[model samples]
Target chain A: MTMTATTDRTLPDPADRRAAAHAFIAGQARWRWPEAVFWLVAAASLVIFPHSLVLAAQVLIAGLFALSLDLILGLGGIVSLGHAAFFGLGAYTAGLLAAHGWNEPLTGLVAAGLVAGLVGFATSFIVVRLKGIALLMVTMGVALLLHEVAQKAHAITGGDDGLQGISMAPILGLFSFDLYGRTAFIYTLAVVFACFLVARRLYNSPFGLALKGMRENGRRVPAIGGSIRRHSALIYTIAAVMAGIAGGLLAQTTEFVSVEVLGFQRSAEVLIMLVLGGAGLLYGGFVGAAVFLVARQILSGIDQTYWFFWLGLMLVLVVLFARNGLLGGAKALLARWRRA
Target chain B: MLLSLANILFNGVAYGMLLFLIAVGLSVTMGLMGFANLAHGAFAMLGGYVTATLMAKAGWPFFATLPAAFVLVALASLVLERALYRRLYRAGELDQVLLTIGVVFMAVAGATFVWGPSQAPIRVPAYLTGTVAIGPFDWGVYRLFLIAMGALVTLALIVGLERTRFGAMIRAAVDNPRMATGLGINVDRVFSITFMLGSGLAGLGGALGVNLIGLDPSFPIKYLVYFLIVVAVGGLGSIKGSLIAAIVLGVCDVAGKYYLPDTGAFIIYVIMVSLLLWRPLGLFGRR
Candidate 1:
């Protein structure tokens, strides 16, 4: 045992291991064929599904929101039930800006992201310190607080009446939000694509790898010179920004913002979307959002009244048997097939 | 001024008692069992509906339905714990949360369909109608009755959990299930019983709260934050902590509503977040 241990001490030199890690990171950072196909299909849907642009735009928004949630949940191992706090903030930010004459779509998104990130940073002190259910409650509390505030602030939010009569200028002073839903779909798709690109790049970076280590064993990460608070705060803020932009997209695309944008149901819906897609994987949010929205559309079309029951049943079925969600199930099947 | 203040205090304490009644079970389920049962408020909603149905449709007195609600909801919870919740005890935290959330959704949908999404009204019995003299001032008999019931329940829980052999088994099981199992304790049975008790109390609390808080389809979602606040602030598994936290939050809620209606509801959420920040494990949590 002693001789074997001594031999291991000098094996697989540190430099070689470092080089291997870089190669692995580079390989992961490179876009895979599946991602290329996914985006291509998404962009192509603009023409393929000409009549479904509105729903398509909505899917993109939910996808972006779910993607933001995925960052903290799948990557940082932070679980929350109130991620709508940032989304709501973003929506309101863009809505209020449009209401107050700053209707430039892209800039509105930036402002939404900044506001959401600031709120996230402010809350990070509390968020970073918690784990499991406690974290869920705190995050929920923040969202509920925001929801309550939104409901009560009648002058600013228009209370239950919602923020109405707000309009945004055309994208880049050229493409106006048309009645045919083309501009909104393209705008949302472009924004979602941009955010996804940044998120995808970050997912395989050295910092992202360190985050995975933190998620696996937080105590060990601290021992290895990682500041858990700093990493969590940064990722949490980035996710919040992404969520905010999604919210901003909704406000800009729809030309309205309602108090329900900040509701607990919205938060829960996005969580379901993320879970349905599968967490951690970058494409999981997009896939989950697509399935959830399309399923919701079909269900609501059939029975508008009892749709919540169907949703509940779906979530229950998902949690019970498909804990890792559809993508995970497919991957598991793939692994078994390979083994066979 | 003194009398109104006294009235607010009385109402606030009564509210706090009701909150404690609902949240104490969650304190155990989440704090002791380490399961995030977000649907806890659903059990409370079920209790409220049972009471409403018994009093309104079945011509039962308001007081008579409380026990029925407790018994019925306890039975329902037993079925749920056995078939659904039991499967996820050893599962991931998120799965447990999602499952319970799913349960909440189903319960909400069921209630909405059965009860038509309207508030279920329970008649305030003649016995609890008017104010009675206490010291120099008259206080509402209903509020006084709520306080008395809350105190009785608290005492019973403390004695039952601390003085009984079953309670010892529960503590052992919660602290270390492996060791408790090794020592011949039936951990599963203990957990089921504990869950039943927790859910039963929730039902009773819900039944009792109908007059003050009202019973509705949205009850579970609406008061979820408050129940969670009580459990989190009080510290998981600490009955004493929950009672204190409930009373503190109840008073704050009541006072805030009365004093500053515009921002009163926001205060509790802020307080919960701030307290959790200071005591992440909770004010009295051991873990």
Candidate 2:
């Protein structure tokens, strides 16, 4: 009996080892100093710029969109060019809901998430099977189709006049959406923060590690007893939900939804934002959205027609020189500083 | 009803030929060279603009401007390949996409700056203006010209690729670049020439298609999807596949527009998605 017990102790169960590793990784990811500092700085920005609440709200929505993209592209290694499908779906759902008198914010957001998640779930089966350029084409096709549908469905979508007269109610029977966007900013921030926490939890989970493994080497996933299709579909659905929430937030704050919400340009712009911030890192979305949105606002003010020229040039330079994006560049610099 | 069907078939074939002309070069670059060039539509736009400018401003005949468009676009592509695209041969698909997208934006913006934000109108020669009566069907003379041009180019391409020494060299280089290099074939030069050839064809297509598709600052963005669809559905690197796919797409698009006027451009995408789902590697694409 003692010999058998010794042998069992010698060869620990694989499941136990996995659990221990997961716990260790989860511990490591819990409330890092950098994350704390990042959130602190973000909070401080709201305090410092009291008047720029609308812009702040817009940035938060953009950041949320970027984050949703990051979950699929960065972590799951699914490069989608049509993520605006979910965002638009969410926006339209919330916009329609408000326009038709279901003006509650939280319920509308949840409905948006569910609608987008349903769409994502339905599409993921077909989409997850594709890789590389084929995947890109399919995603693009979906977005283009949605855009055309939205454009042509004039009776319901308002046909380029945009879905208007969407009046959202106060947050939790208080904090009405003021013209100054004070309530909008705080509500957006809170939603983003809540979504960020969920994403963070997912990132440190066993499923996230599995996704990481697949990203590194897709072939090895099955050998280790993981289903790429199942995992991809799950992540895609979750990402869609997150994107839906972002879109709903935008609609609620702005009280409008345009066909532009479903445009290919929006998809491309979100991709550019994610790439600019640095993919693979959780905070990269926030950083990228802030920089891209702010830069666009400034550049458009300077020369509305010629702003894309500068934006295009920046994208080219970034892809050529800074493949890892702004955050990656910063990380590299910090590492160098520490080494020195 | 029969006459409308005939007209649709004829128009579809003409449009398909135009798409083939634009997409063939893109397929060669994407499939043969392994480069994801989203700026290819820009080259086609350049060709159209060149043709339009010469015809409208210089009083050049429409037919005479086609070759000029081809040559100019070819030369431009050659210069760009040497200066920029050559360096990105080994870059990831994401980088390639971003770089090409940037080029597209720049091209669009530059075109807008140079030629004001208006569609460039084309004046077809008088002989090519009217329709021809054939067994109770009216076929546009300009469309006949396009069909003829497409056939000639397809014939030349097939003969050149299959029955010539230069064609063998290209095939060899594409199949095994390392082996071709070992055999002392200047693979780089072969690629450059091929790239130029592809760009030239796109230019020719653009020059020919300007009247049919319209030309404007947003030309690249507008037609990029169509070209990409042709290349993708044709099963990249296959000329015959592109030809077949383009024809099918053209027919479907015309039919969809005629039947379902409400959906506008949605049907083609639906077709693309369904087809892609059925065959992920494209209809004729290799595993």
Candidate 3:
């Protein structure tokens, strides 16, 4: 880490600049190793833990969902408890296309992303100016509007029964989504890895740095020539696309879409999952979605009625003790142990 | 068509009054404490539930049960403040949002467990049941009662918040807690009192609102967003603002249901979004 930091400032202008470059490089190095390890482990798990492929696939989708949330909540300083607006919109778009005989999964996914992104762009104009609870409330109003439309309009959306008939033909007309869950799992995993790559690149980019600064001090960001509204709008749109892609993935795998996708609970669940894993940390989304989904699964299997109670308890605990989430908490403990 | 308009206005006023009752507390909590009380609607639900159970199941009279409902809901909120909300007082926006959301979830789930998923039907006394005919118009007596109650509360609250020492102290605390603390005001005590008062109003709204919307397990969750929108539009922590905004939203929403049936619910959201665009600080809210 020290060597990388020194080399990062081989052509620095000042001492502080040199130190910042070194720190940046060291942070990059730290991120790279774990990223590589996660990919390797992810590949190995596919081969070794094939029975859990379905669970892993769902985690990948949900992780992407959580990542979309982290972009706004973690980086952009926008706390939205109703992110499912884009997620559900994308799902419905994909589902509608598939039900209408669109067989190409990639095409459906892209279309879903575009449609949700467009909606996000339209709504972001209204949402960008407001801060704190007002922003949260506006986003929720948008989601609720979409939900009401979906529920009441039976002809198009099939209402509460949901648009059911959906079928993805194959990937590149090659791999079939067989009953064994292999094709579906691999497909989702690949999408998640691609999204992860893009997200990481974006985080380390100038845009991402500016967002971090904006979160820390909004006034300072603009003083340095950054348009806060533009940055917020841009990041919100990107997050919406990511959320849309996650929604498309859900449609491809589950082949079912419901109005509940746009509900406040869906948004709240994502927020909980994102916070639980750790926000701002890139891989925190994955950790949070995995732990939260698994816990919910196990608890539901034991008794479906008490799942909310347990989930609520976990949320409260995460807020009180694990402020940075599970990974951050674990990292802190590790650092303490090493110091000892 | 005339009847439909009348019906819309009637429903709108009734709906707005209940909304004001439920949301006034939320606005105060949000404005004063800077905490989002997502569980505010749940208190309203609890009030309805308690009132319904007492009247329908436990054989209690309407007059006695009404006050009892406020006391019960207020007590629950006080307990909540002491144990959970107080700890969350200084937390970040996300923490408050998530924690309050957790409270909302638990409240809904707990209510479900206790009351079951079935809708509970509640009614007012026979004396307050029939409609009052005005010219060619006949309106539900209960709805008129709700309107009267809202107007009375508005008048009382306006006088209380703007004129009284307690109101001045509360306002001072809201504007600047540190300054109020420095001035030797008991901020904590003030916070507790405000929370209880807000929660009691929500409870009252819930009890009165039961006749119109009935009691359902998901009512809190469904109406949570609606209440928030009203609070946002009215400006945070302004009782008069909440009253005006609630009535406007209630009227527009109900009218839309009759006039633009196809886009009924969406109309309200559209209006909210437009209003937000026009005045991000809300109609009466100051920066």
Candidate 4:
């Protein structure tokens, strides 16, 4: 036993090194069984209800939008009521590009993301300094400013009538956007999946951990040698890019854009959707968007006049009872059930 | 150009008075309670609707309906504070925002259901209508009345908050709730009364502002940003600050709308953003 111990101390075990490497990779990937199941369900839904692809695509786009908000509000501890600024900026950029003859989907999407990211980067210096209501005001102010600009710049934005004649080219120069929205759904799903993978990787990264730390105690982060401002600005820019991509997807799919994209109501609705699904968790955005859109569809169909009343009541109740949101509530129930 | 400038100044001051009336309560509640109530405008809308309905349907005079509007909206706000807002005193700002926004949505929908989603027509008394020549300028009697009311209310608020025994209790409660409670002050009662006063003032402002700002189902959402700007720029709890900020905003808005009609609200927003960036704590706010 002494000889074995001496040998172990003198020479590092190859098996132990292999196990450590495997553990590092696993930590990096962090893919759970449930995540795989979620992807499977998403794919199965696409196949099961081909006719509802348009609605599904919209839900996915909203999910991406909400996800972008979640990164700032949930993970980075930055509450913004104007994430629609990025989304609207992206939509207008893509819409204008398509209208002016750069109709290629991928190129437009990239341009949209880059433009939104640049704006976010520029504004983050101002935005990240404020907390609580001040932050909310500045973000809302930015969006309101953008909305006004869009409304006045009628030559490019089409004013209140909306940007028309945005004809998108085929995906990969092969599959065309169809009337039934089959290609749109597949294209959106692919983008969402790609973005989700990147987000998942980000959430598990060292930078992400630092953000979580900042959220909990911002002062402590700097004490621990983390650059809170840089991380926050970077995350804000990334989230903006994601939101831009979502907006670009929406514009491309619908082939139109409007001033309403930058409206306060849209920003409020996205915030509501993010809170409804859950925040903090990466999948919360997707779940919230799905639930909110579906619920809205059903509620409006039932009684258009009183749909807002119900929505309002639901929001109040959610804030009162389920502060952590629906996904968090569901997770708690599951945990309790397992313990039982 | 001189006449136009004078006209702008008069109109701006009148509009600013209306904003001060609406936003002073918001500033007080936010500073004292540390609660971000986005539904303050909803109460103002309620007051406006009530006054309009009473004037139109019940054949009440505009002056008579103002008191009724104040009392009714104050009572409504009281019930809401006791039942809902009281529970959320310790909740996070986000939750407060969500709850208040929900209230706003409900209020807007309710207003739409009752008022038919159109602007409620407000008819001022014959005496209050039309322009009266004063010195080199002709001012609307209603605008003059608004300015007078605004001045009286500001004086009353300053006296009440700074001089009265109840005001002392309120100040104590706001500065140190636990200490106030320990010293035998009924903090809850003070809070409730303060809330009622704020809401009552908001209602009065709404009734007064119907002609200038318009009254409709979308009134709350339409003027929410304006009210917030006033409160933010005025330094949350300072009535004097709100008064100044509201007047400045009113002037800027009136001037911007007249001079740069094509640009819409672009200039006002630029001013607000720049002001906020420059003085995040507000012009008169203390750390």
Candidate 5:
């Protein structure tokens, strides 16, 4: 009698829960109009702003880099100070490939992603255990170590002078890179869009929800049958692969790689971009990259020597006034306006 | 071979002392207060610039510049603490990091504007220059001075923190802020003073460093990793741990470079990872 009663009550719960989960995932994955607008704007930029394709290509690369960071930062709530380690590795991977005569662009990217992913998998074990200041220092230490290694292996990495004479094969043997940057822009946009699709899908999945659950409450995640370390480490490695591809894109587009690619400043700059655009939001990376690149271009134009002053001021003001960053703040305002 | 080993040992100790001096203050604030104050390096940079400007522009001797660096950076820290950092004491880690990074950027630009982008040269008095013969080996006079200064500062800090009534109050506040307040201690004032004191020490370290590391706009970022490493390995809020940690790291780093020649930089980082994995709280940190 007791077993029958328990079965009657609990049987519907699992089915109901599963259905609810499916509905939630579907709702999140459902195509939003703004996402369409976003792609439309990107496509139109190729035509509307053809002269600025080079900058647009750079912007897309930065966006992709930031997006990769968001995978860990937004979902896992893991703050990494050494993301540039992967970026630089990817760049070097692509650079070396081209330098050694395997200049095919598409294959070069795959190799870059694989190499970075391998390193990420190795380091993720160490990264997943630490938190707060310890996490920050360790990540910084890892990057600095890589930076040191690269400098010492100058014979292979070009040392202080940076790798020279890197050129890439045309896209699918059809579109060659031109000085006007049309090929670069289209190529970069296509790659970033594909990555975005993956990120969007992953963010709406049950696995991503589990990672988010751990971020909200680590203890609760365990109770819900999730392994905190495994989720964190896997997400970290995935992000590293994405970051690697971004770096590869940069190397291919620029046709060069410098020792500065793996620098502490580069890591800090990317983190700043992510936070400035409101980290944790899927589209925040794109907005942050656009703002940062534009700001960099405009500020440098105003005065090369003191542009940093204005950027610093902007950062301070943003932190003080808008704690959640530009996108978060804007969304809050929209919410408030609608209620009123 | 023996002479070279000794030489390496001496150089390593000197470098380690400099690292200790630069990081000890950060160790205290970060360890005890639980603040991620990365801009501590900026204060150190300010101190270096101050020393450089005084020596270059006004022709002050090295000794005179040191005190000025300490007092000035301390005052500047006080201003920043009161106006900016005070608001973020309870904020998230990201807020603290971004705010400090902003400060570093501003400081770098400010230094560049005032001092230009070149490395600022420092001239130590002749007495602090040249080598002195000690037991069949010539030891660098400047390096010997650095060791002496490092030891003196350590002794002073140890005595000040362990013996003084102010130290007790500071310790109490860090241990239990609410309880310290209930005990009639002004916790705010204590933290402010401690923070200023830490900044002043960093400034002193920076002024002292000018002769060794040289002063530049990139000073903060250039040595940021080394400082952070010392604190991380040393354990927060423990002077003895920092001393031991700094000495070990300094020796390893210098010796690795000397022997390995090519892959010298790899050793210290390896040591750090191994140590932290074994003991995440560092050499003396509490849970």
Candidate 6:
């Protein structure tokens, strides 16, 4: 009687699946208005203000960079100050490959991602062992060591003079990279969209949920029989691949690479961009990159040196007041305004 | 071969002494307060820049500007601690790292705005400029001066930290802050003082280091990782560990550059990794 009762409950799954799908669709429909409006505004801004496209491209790259950071940092609770290691590695790889007679842009880009992923995988073993500030210092040390090697290796990397001559054959050989950066912008935007979709999928996956649990309480995760090291290492590797792709895009578009690609500044800037965008939130990175790149461009144009003071004040203010970055704060403020 | 070895030894000791001066504070801060301050190097840069500008441009004497460098960096550290760092002490390490990063950005920008992007040569006095010979060894008097000054400071600091009441409190706090606080030691005051003291040393290092290393806007960043490694390798929270590690790192780096230029940085990492493998925590650091 008990076996028959259990079988009867288990066998009625096809109708149940349809009902669950309907509920999910209904829930999504409820949130679609706000999501649509946000994207519509983002799209309109890119069209109305053509210059915003350049900013958008930067935001796209920055988002990818920050997304990589968030996977390890926000999800796995690993604080890395040297994420630029992977980004720069990818960039240098792409640039080097393109410079040395590899005409296929996509192939070079994929190579860049693969190389960065390998480095990330190797480094994750070292990184996962350390915790807190010690982890940060060691990771940063790795990046600095790499940076030093890059700087001192004059023959291969072109030293401080920078590696300049990278020629990427047209994307799929049909679309030429134009002078106005239109093709580059669209290409980056497409890449960013694809990455975002994948990141979204991952975040909703079981592994991602397990990582979230680990971040909340590492000890608790172990009690539940989860291997925190393996999860953290895997996420770190994935993030590296994302950062590498971002770097590849950068290398391809800029057609130049330098030792500066791996400098502390690059690392620091990515961190800032991440914080400036709301970390853990999917789109916060893009918002942050846009705000920061635009602010930087405008401020530097006015007076290059004074821009730091502004950035410093902004960072302090953001930390103290906004805390959630520009978009997060703006959303809250708008909500309050509407309520008022 | 002997002369080259000696030369390497001399250069290593000198460089290590400078690293020690900068790193000692990082060790203290990281060990004592658990604060990961990336901007400490910025304080050093500030000291170098201030000393350079005052000594070179404002025509201040070495003796006069040396104290001024200490005072300025100390004040800056105190202000930073009070204004920003206090809020960050309880925040996660990532926040602290990022906040300091912001400060570094500001400092770099400010330095660039004020001094342009050129490397400013900070000249020592004529009396301290030339070399001094000891038997077969010829050493720059200024380098020797730096070593002597560093040793003196290290001695004084060791005595202060080990012998004084403040030292006892600091030790107690480092060992068990809760017990120290329960015993009526002002932990907050200790944290501020420790930060100031550490940063003061960094300033001193910067000012003194400029004679050898020169001053640049990116100077802080170049030494930031090195200083952190010293603090980390020496074991967090112990002044003696920092001192020993700094000197060891300094000598090793100098020797490596001379003996194995291709693998100098690798050697330093090897040492650090090996040390960690042996001690896990650090040389003098307790788990």
Candidate 5 lDDT, A1-340, residue by residue in tens: 9999999887777779899889989998899898899889987889999999999999889999999999999888998888999999999999999999999999999999999999999999999999887788788778878988999999999977989889988999999999999998999999999999999888999999998899889899999789999999999999999999999999999998987889888898888888889888888888888999999998899886577887677778878998778899999999999999
Which candidate should be chosen as best, given DockQ against the real structure? 2
Per residue, candidate 1 scores C-alpha lDDT tens digits across A36-72 of 8988998998879999999999999999999999999
Per-residue lDDT over B110-210 for candidate 5, one digit per residue giving the tens place of the 0 to 100 score: 99998889998888899999999989899999999999999999999988988999989988988899999999999999999999988998999999988
Candidate models: Cα lDDT each: 0.90, 0.90, 0.86, 0.90, 0.89, 0.82
- Model 6 Cα lDDT, one tens digit per residue, B200-265: 989999999997878888777777778877887888877778878888888888888877787548
lDDT, residue A310, candidate 2: 78
Q: Could you give the fnat of all candidates in order?
A: 0.70, 0.66, 0.51, 0.62, 0.62, 0.42
Candidate order (DockQ): 2, 1, 4, 5, 3, 6
lDDT of 6 at A60: 76
- Chain B alone, candidate 5, TM-score of 0.97
User: Which ranges of candidate 4 are over 4 A from the true structure?
Assistant: A1-29
Query: Which residues of candidate 3, in runs, are more than 4 Å off?
Result: A1-23, A26-33, A47-49
In candidate 4, the residue pairs with backbone N, CA or C atoms under 3 Å apart (3 or more residues apart, or in different chains) clash, namely: A277-A288
Indicate the worst ten consecutive residues by lDDT in candidate 2 chain B.
Answer: B278-287
TM-scores of the candidates are: 0.96, 0.96, 0.94, 0.95, 0.96, 0.90
Q: Candidate 5, clashing residue pairs?
A: none
Candidates 5 and 6, the one with greater lDDT: 5
Clashing pairs in 6: B31-B237
Write the residue-wise lDDT of candidate 1 on B78-159 in tens digits. Answer: 9999889888888878888888888888898899989988888778778897998979889989889999999999999889
lDDT by residue (tens digit), candidate 3, A1-340: 9997898778556888868866885586455566788778877777988888888888889999999999988899898766999999899989999999996999999998999999989878777888776777778878888888888888888877878788888899999788867898889888888888888878877778899999999889999999999999998999999899999999888888888888777888888889999999988889999998889889989866478777878887888788999989988998999999
Q: What's the i-RMS of each model? A: 1.2, 1.0, 1.5, 0.9, 1.5, 2.6
Candidate 6 yields a Cα-based lDDT of 0.82
Candidate 3: lDDT of A39? Answer: 77
The segments of candidate 1 whose C-alpha lies over 4 angstroms from its true place after superposition are A1-15
Model 6 residue B273 distance off true place after TM-score fit, in angstroms: 6.0
Worst 10 residues of 5 chain B by lDDT: B264-273
Ten-residue region with minimum lDDT total, candidate 3 chain A:
A25-34
